[model samples]
Target chain A: MAALCGHGAPIALLSPAYNEAVTIVQSVRSLLSLQYPAFEVIVINDGSKDATLDTLIEAFELKPVSRAYDLAVPCNEIRGVYASPRLPRLVVIDKVNGGKADALNAGINISRAPVLCSMDADSLLEPDSLLRAVRPFVEDPERVIAVGGTVRLANGCRVRDGRVVEIGLGRHPLALFQTVEYLRAFLMARLAWSRMGALTIISGAFGLFRREAVVRAGGYTRGTVGEDMELVVKLHRQMRREKRDYRIAYVPEPVCWTEAPESWRVLGRQRSRWHRGSLETFFRHWAMFLNPRYGRVGLIGFLNIFIVDVLGPVIEVLGYILIPVLWLLGILSVEYLLAFLALSFTFGITISVCSLALEEIQLRRYPKARDLALLTLAAIFENFGYRQINNLWRIRGLWQYLRGSESWGVMTRKGFRAG
Target chain B: MTGGLLGGLWTASLLMAASSVLFMTGLVIARLISEAGRARRRARREALVADMMSAMDGEADAARLKSEVREPRLVARALLELSTLIRGRELAAVTAALTQAGAEPALLRLMRSRNGEDQIAACEALGLFPSDKAAAALKTRLKRRTSMRVRIAAARALLQMGETPDLNDLLAAFDIGEVHAPLELSAILDEIARRATEAYLERLKSSRDAPALRAMMVGVLGRLGRYEALPVLLGAASDPEPSVRAAALSALGALGHPDAEPIIAAALDDPVPEVRAEACDAAGRTALAALAPRLAERLDDDEWLVRFRAASALLRLGEAGRETLDAAAGRASPRAMRTAQMVLAEAAA
Candidate 1:
């Protein structure tokens, strides 16, 4: 609806590109085709040694432009700014190599709109997703500070003209397992927290924010693997300190399709990095844990994170090793062992299945009956081996965090299928 | 030895897992069936609509097709969809068809439906049929304390019906103390400006107490290109609130009227950085060559954005402004020189 009228508030789509020469052109083209009346696409070329900047310049027919912007947030040096005379809404920024957080800050500083949509360069947003994601801000512009949309795996979906033409479950078992995992994480967990008014994290893949709010909160925190979650937590702390009433929303209808890691090594690295980021964000803001001053966000929100992420891995891994040894040594009874196995294994299968069922009943993104059945099987099969391997990865992440490992492991993607 | 309770618990857990699997399968099957049914209904509706359109063109029996369509809501939607594509005599023909099919009464009935979506759709559809009954029904719906969305829809319908609904009545529906004014309200204001600019200008004159609302109104007026509000906008440029002043300066910039040059020039020296930024933008938009020295002086401003805008504004000027920027590049402070050089490099490229 906002596409028809010029009255919609201006928004800036800020994407950080790093060595993504393969997908950069398609992603940028998709962004320019978003169904919004007033918006601009700001793609930050984050010092890629590859052909990211050159590919963009050649593809867009870009030329240097005299644009004025403030360094509202900290970022690296900018080599130059380029714009195309043909596509006026597109602007490219070439800056030195900084992490994703630094690149986002560079884009924020250069952005002129009051609202900003931060997304990854590899992700593809549905055409109407921006309008749907920005509805909360239009409705209550004062109180809503941020919003996140559902992130679906784009592994096996059909792509046409840089859009997901058909929704298909990825054939890879790893990708299928992640499809179920993401459904649980976004649909159940995020929605539950959002209803309590204590949503802590908006995924870095796709989130909308009030420019002034993010700028006042000191932009995205640099040198953190979990910059997205950290910035949201920092916003909560700042708003609570100032005694301001604000909301961090999660809208499930708007979908942003992203490529999930397919191989075991890459998946392990991703899981570990995610766990490390969670630990880093947790310890960094430990004072908010059970603190009354931050209200439900401190008491309920941090408690959930502390139990599920910070402590869940260590206990699960210990149970896996120690339980069998104890039973073999006659220190624990066989009945008790069977009970433990039933609770851990069967209960997990139950949760994953119900999550898949909920997705089918509600969203129906998986249209084919065969794909639905395959996903259902994946949900059940994941509990046996995949879930155990994931716990081990998270435990490794815990160890990495303890050892002060700050590396973002190399993540490789088989590029999307051409139209 | 452990009791049998542990054994029974394991058995129960296994049973629970199996049942949940079955439950998921059942739900999936039900959904598939429901989707199929929905597809069937959609196909039937499309066929019926096509038939009705042909009837309207006299290729088919109009009375028979109208009576054959059982779903009033479906028929009403079809007529409304057809209304957007035609004009004049065709629109009149569609209206006659809708009345002949008794769609107006059905729409009124839907307006009173309990479902919020039904009510909203009814309100929107009624906009196409401008009658006293539809207007009265929408006004009644607006008076009720409903959701903001429904109220906004009702108000929009009233406006579309060429009725000058009270601005205060709409404003009363929203909480006044909110920091950021709703964009939907701005959209409504834009709609009102199309038909009744005086109504918006009148509200602008009286809305000083609420700075956020005042700023929003100023923005709306500017976007609508209502040059008649130039006097009000110029006065607002010196308002007590910085946001209002910025909005006024921005509106003036958009207008680019020669009469507002003095105000724009004075705003370049405004106390607030944001106001000065807007003033710089206005200077560039108006292309006042005489303000080149003032613009050059702003190149040394402390704020990064101000300096950047100052340099940009200078480039918007002609040869004299370029000479001033070149001088700044040669002799100004490091910050000013850097900005000037960047702007000059870009212009050269």
Candidate 2:
């Protein structure tokens, strides 16, 4: 927010990139152009095989610097930290290959600020996003560990000058479904949860975190598919255990537009990875389930997570198959099975539509009126195909987990074409 | 013999109906059996939840607790129980379980669902626990959402959280001084919930997001009676966006600002009916006597809401308004008469 310029706290942007020669410059540009005055850009070059390191150095006119490292964060090894020869506020880290998590860690290790931001290489942040995100940390010094900005589907949205000015629906149905899901997910689900004071994950693509809280929780867990969720959970565990006052917040207006999986292959991989991350996080924190000593947060919050989120696909898929099959076999009656299915579908659609209506009542972002109509249709159609396909991917993810497949596969990125 | 034959035909018809009934009953019975199975599965899930809840009184084993109640419904029930615990002032254990459970993407996905009661329940759970996960989800739920239940729960949670970014966002998003945030926010926090403070800070942080944020900043300044934001509010009053300007005026009026009189008076002539209504409210809020004549002009508006709004504004003018309204009422001009009567009653009350 322009109003937040010269105000709020200093924010350090961290982009841990590997082989992202195509989009690192754009990402860095967005950070440098932030509306807030106190922010400095930090880009971690995680041993990219391509000219990712050279590209950033050349573009920003990079120079090396000996930076002291006491940010209270536990992170991967860093090769060296650099600052811009032209723009001193811009910092770069040339780090060994540690993947996204490692690069973020290195950035965290080198950042010199109160609040830290993590951004994906291909993501675009609104100029005001940083101020909007970090304001929580400054206002409530005693509490407030992290804050998440809204993430929008960038596949169809027009991007220019490293910013997304106009938002649009995706061209392909896969991207479209994801777009709707992101809207419903962030706009509905995350908003509702944050209001409830039980936010678990601050997405890695765009979020601000307190350096100490994150470091105390052991920075980003290396080799993890979803360090975002893991870090949040770890933060919750530590903060609540110490009985310290803290919060992970959500900001509605500060948006980050990132590419979604536009094709089936990509969607499948993304969904599977997400599922794996969830499973891994669940497995690690399994002890907190309904345990009162951890108080309401542990027993209730984690318990709900286990039931409503963790094992949702397993029961859902089984239920879908069993009821229909049993009815066809003259075991369970067709009429009854249909009724059950209809009730589930009806309720699901009702909720989705209501969420759509909420969007209309509060933030109507899609430029066209028809977009709302289309989104509503998308909500209805989701139960038929999108939900099922995702369910399939989730179930497959579980199956893979059972087979001890821990490695995350390659994800396609068409990269943000100049919109 | 003819009567007997007729009775036999009726008997046959009754028999056919009885057979159809049997078939239908048979179908229903079979359905019941399957529902029982699903219910049994649910029961198993709930049993695990019950155990987790019971065991959670001591150590937090969210990972284990979730193993028992993996069904969203069961989890919803567990979360409901969890909400009660948090509501009861016991937050630590349940929050841990919530975090542990939320790690499951499906549960997170389901909990994030807009319309599901289970989603609402998860929101409630997060509210009780006051964890990062819950806070994040509830904040996201604030925008472009559907369910009032979800929204209310989210708002209540943030209200409980106090002065956080989410609170700030909510204040920014929903703070029209004339229109409050569902009235639930008023009752949600007695003490300054840390989360509320966080929300307040967040709003201040993102106050540049236009109408919502600008309007909220003015409203908060007006409601909290902050003189510091006066210039900002005045600037906002003449904003290019009518809604933003009106919001600023309305906030100014609420704060009883003398400076907004001309703007409020001018807004009475706005092209938009809503702007006119807001201007009328602003006039009442500001107690701008100069706008009384201008406000009377709206008593003839085609829109009944404007007439009422104008009447209300006029009512603040005391004897002057009573006289104008009486003239309209006496004349039995439909719009003015009805609005005049209601205003007279409201003013008298």
Candidate 3:
């Protein structure tokens, strides 16, 4: 066959970091090792109280540079800009504490590439991920505004010099359960949704976008907790309103690896924040809910997010509490209860196992049969208690959302085990 | 009646749970078997590739090499590996050997298969063989298949074959109304620009094409730096559509042709701000000393991008332009002054 094109288009990779000193250097190293020919790495140090900036400066020999940036997108004030003489492609922006969305906007302002990728500071990208993720942009430059790839859990993986050296199931049960959950969300639901041309969420861990489209959509909104999802929805709304053809794609390959919360406390905070963000985004774009003007995005995608994602948890939590009471009051039959439990647990396990199987069929990161077996066990185990607890967390998040709480709780991380 | 209904539900649930468990077990086993099979196949292919390489170095008989790697899949894999590592006469020899082994027909059959996975794999394999037959099969697939994956594979295979598909055919395949990933289109266009510049130019001359299509082709021409197409591009610069004019101006900038300077300078007065922005960028790229004054005037363009590009163009004009920007930074309109200061700060860094 013909030789692949020598050089793909240039890309600007934006990673918004906050108090991530432990993983910042490693992440930068990984970005440096990407296989794409033309790209730049811009890390927005979002006023981290930790030594994130110091670590980056020391690792890359960063020196302050008086750079010029057009404030096309609104963002917080940047304290300073630094560039490494040693690694010319690496740029760091020291900005005030403006959350993830604001940091991304600041990076977008300074980015010069036609294509931009917004990613998390703690996520590690596969060497060929950019090359693969960039395929869609090269194929349909006119309509494809954004593309997202599957994000896998890195909690159990072996790392050496910022690369995944080996794949294994995490020792932590919570981490294992999260791994299975991620597989289901990314491999099955996302692929199906993208095929229908109604994919809504491009994980903030790693999403590639057309620079012009993002600017036209007014960049990431400041107040939304789900900036990533909100930006995608806004892009959909904007492009549709302008009567332009566009697509938001989801690539099934595992392009990004992130550390999942290993402890229950951290996991609870993360899930609650996620649920609250979903609630806010759902309410914010309520016009699209069942609105014919938005087409499938409104009718199918919006409804799915509402009924399945937002409301399903509430219904499940209520069932958990009310079912036992009904049984005691003789309003529910013992046989019916047994049947419901069997169906729910079995169906849940079946879906999770199928997702694992799908992963095994394509881009099998897990190397060992034992790892697959363990993941399957975790899928079954999650249905027994973990899933219920997650539902409870969503319920609590709904309560907080109703009460008008807007706080993003702190999340502690145990840094990757680097070689 | 309620008791019977409950019993039926319980039985159904019990059966479902059992079947699901069995299904999970079956999938696990199937995965294990598939993994083992893949490992074995990979090892065999690796060994065959090693032998093929040695043979190519004149250490073994070519006939023996072909016979040893007789399996169609193995032959395709070996050829793909060799294509990347060797070129010219060595590559021709490998291709000839693979063709004699019936690799082309085998791949063509696979390309026509109903299985999507098999079809994609065949497209990848066909990229190694640049024959008329391979190109025809790929083009047929491109026309016949509506599956985006199949179409992409076919297009990539045709590009690999070094076949210059008609620009119209490509545009038709990449319908504007249909959502296609930009990266894939860019790659195809880049390949066509690199290998089939003449065909692209021919297509660019057709006024009958859609504006979006013409715009894209013009963009490709610019990217290819086809200096010979300067006259056509200059004519396109005055097209009725603003997008076409903007694209043509961008191409002129990319081509960096000094002769286009007069035309580009005239575009500064275009009604559309986008066209003016491209004109300003082109001025910077060509860096005509005479355009520096004109570019300086544009620093006051109402559009922020136009002003930004104007200041950038002036900076590219060396000492004279820098002096102009300095004056603007000191006493021009607020927007112009801010733009000049920003450009100056960037230059200092």
Candidate 4:
């Protein structure tokens, strides 16, 4: 039974490529190289005008077929969910230009499997990522509704034979900031919440959900900036109301790595979209806030999501806005203002550093002394400017959400390769 | 103005802004370094533990397993898991590793745990692994050992062919509470309890365990259809604990002791509603129609829970409970009370 680690499951990967010509091949190759006994890769050319579809066809010998099945989520119109007979498992959904949500919905409806995982098209998975990702479901039935594997900063990490070989430091400052932020968020924030069984988001980049639960929750909502958060919240609402025992989960293993935005413009757009989606989810289920009928999920769970999480960035922005005024108005003396900022900065740095310590305590990542020193510096420096910039972007996101604006922007990738 | 009081003030203000700028630069630098190092070690740690399980037999091997391993808890777990895998004495190293890891206060607490699986493994690991290696480290827990799991394990180990001296250390670990506790170390505690079972029963004859023990007597005697222990059962009808009194009432009914009817009648007004409620259930169950009127009178009890229970009890008492229940549900009880309304509806239904 133990030897059959990668056996049993017939798997498929759906890479919804929108202007992912640079990453399409690498993503497909990673999926094809999975250690599973049998599996296929499906690259959905989500109406990218670029060489995304052509590159796949030329490289993997793709041929089009009629849309196979229809378990798609409701975001955009599906022109056709296509398939290639040569590599039948390597089907391509040639759909009309719908956003990511529609592309995923198309993939879901077309695919036939009890288990389906959704990942960002640019991201690359480890050889047995799917096998490890699906372990919990096989081991414990009914208790687990979704399983999320770990994602690391792909910025400086060396990709060798489609696997991360040596962990390298990146030269780009923006990419570096994202690495620390992702580490702190995943290692500290998500770990704690998942431990408490209040995991709200199963990251858009790398997360797996039980096919039936996703469909049962009416799939993903259309025209939402935060489709990930919205779909996860809807699942929580449906499960709690039906009084079902289920869990949205996270694993600590780094199963996938995607390109982080090296440019501030792309990073700002990502943060803005995340904030807008979070607000939409909370406001959509505002009724569950403090309602005891929902049990532990209602009061404790939703309250944490709403106040501590969704509204946190905005509150932080306000704190930033208030500090300057307080100093100018003499409500706060110069020394007092500096001290308060110092204390808050120190506190933020401490949490990151402690998270690094705890992660190391459980599973040490940076083996080299220089790597440890670099991570320590990153932990200390993360709280200052990057946090402020994030707050500003989140504020912008909140403003855009209130103004009813939606931006389905595309992110450029610097393809995964050997260091 | 040259580096004096006013100059100090100006320099301090300048430094504040500089600190903010420096802070921003620090954050950028940190991000740079963090991105440089992202590590992944797939499932290799579990395999390491599986290896340690059997290599733990020797003190040197145990020390090496303990010292060399990163996460002793996981290693110990892997050791146990490996022990399950192969049909051999391979887990010596694993238990040795666990005992070394278990020297920590938290793990020691786990070793002497009241919990089922966790404690058993910890106990077995501590005992099976060379005890001499962890003896000095465990010496501190001598007094606490008397608390539960240790005493049981100690008594069991003492019964084995031959073991080293340290009776005082073992005795200090034996002082424990008398209650039937559901502890993480319950089995170990119970095993220890077995060592003093004769003395415990002697103590029980004049102790608080007398009530729970007496209730057991009621169960035994009632099943035999004998009226013996009636005095004890009647005395327990007034016991402080409602659960004890309820047990007595149940026993009296099973025995068909007519002498308990008066005490059962008075107990219907017992302040602790459950006792009164259970007494009513036993009375009604035993064909005590004579007590039906008194039970029916409780239909309008102040505590709505009691009133609901009485209505439920009366419902089982047949048509004889109608007149009393009907009056309780009459216009005297306002529609504002939903409990009464529910009771009336349930009785009608």
Best by lDDT: 1
Query: What TM-score applies to chain A of candidate 3?
Result: 0.96
DockQ of candidate 3? 0.30
For TM-score, candidate 3 versus 4, the one ahead is 3
Worst 10 residues of 1 chain A by lDDT: A1-10
Model 2 DockQ reads 0.01
True contacts kept of 3: 0.35
For model 3, residues B1-349, the per-residue Cα lDDT tens digits are: 9888777777776776677667767767877888899899888787777766665664545576566544666666566667778987776666666566566888787777687767887887798788888888888888873677778788888877777777678767766553223445656777777777777677777766655555666776677887988988998899886767887898898899999987998999899877898899889888887988899899888766688889888888899999999999999988788889988997887
lDDT of 4 at B10: 49
**Selected candidate, larger TM-score, 1 vs 4:** 1
Runs of candidate 3 exceeding 4 Å displacement: A1-9, A240-244, B1-8, B11-19, B61-67, B89-198, B207-216, B235-246, B262-276, B297-304
State how far residue A108 of model 3 sits from its true place (Å): 1.9
Query: Candidates 1 and 3: which is better by lDDT?
Result: 1
How does the DockQ of candidate 1 come out? 0.30
- lDDT tens digits, residue span A336-394, model 2: 45545555665566566656656655666665555665666676678797898898899
Q: Which parts of model 2 are misplaced by more than 4 Å?
A: A1-6, B1-349
User: Which candidate model has the greater TM-score, 1 or 3?
Assistant: 3
Candidate 2 C-alpha lDDT tens digits along B1-349: 8556555545554454354334434434544565578678777766665655654575556566656445655665565665554534244555455556553344556675654577766665455555566567777876534465566666666555542443444544453342222323333321222224444434444445544334434444545555555666666666665545655665666677777677777778877555677788878867777777777779878654467678878777777766777777677566667667756754553
Over A197-292, each residue of candidate 3 has an lDDT whose tens digit, in order, gives: 899899999999988789999999986678999999999999888988888888887479888998898899888888888888889899999998
Local distance difference test, each candidate: 0.83, 0.67, 0.82, 0.61
Worst 10 residues of 2 chain A by lDDT: A1-10
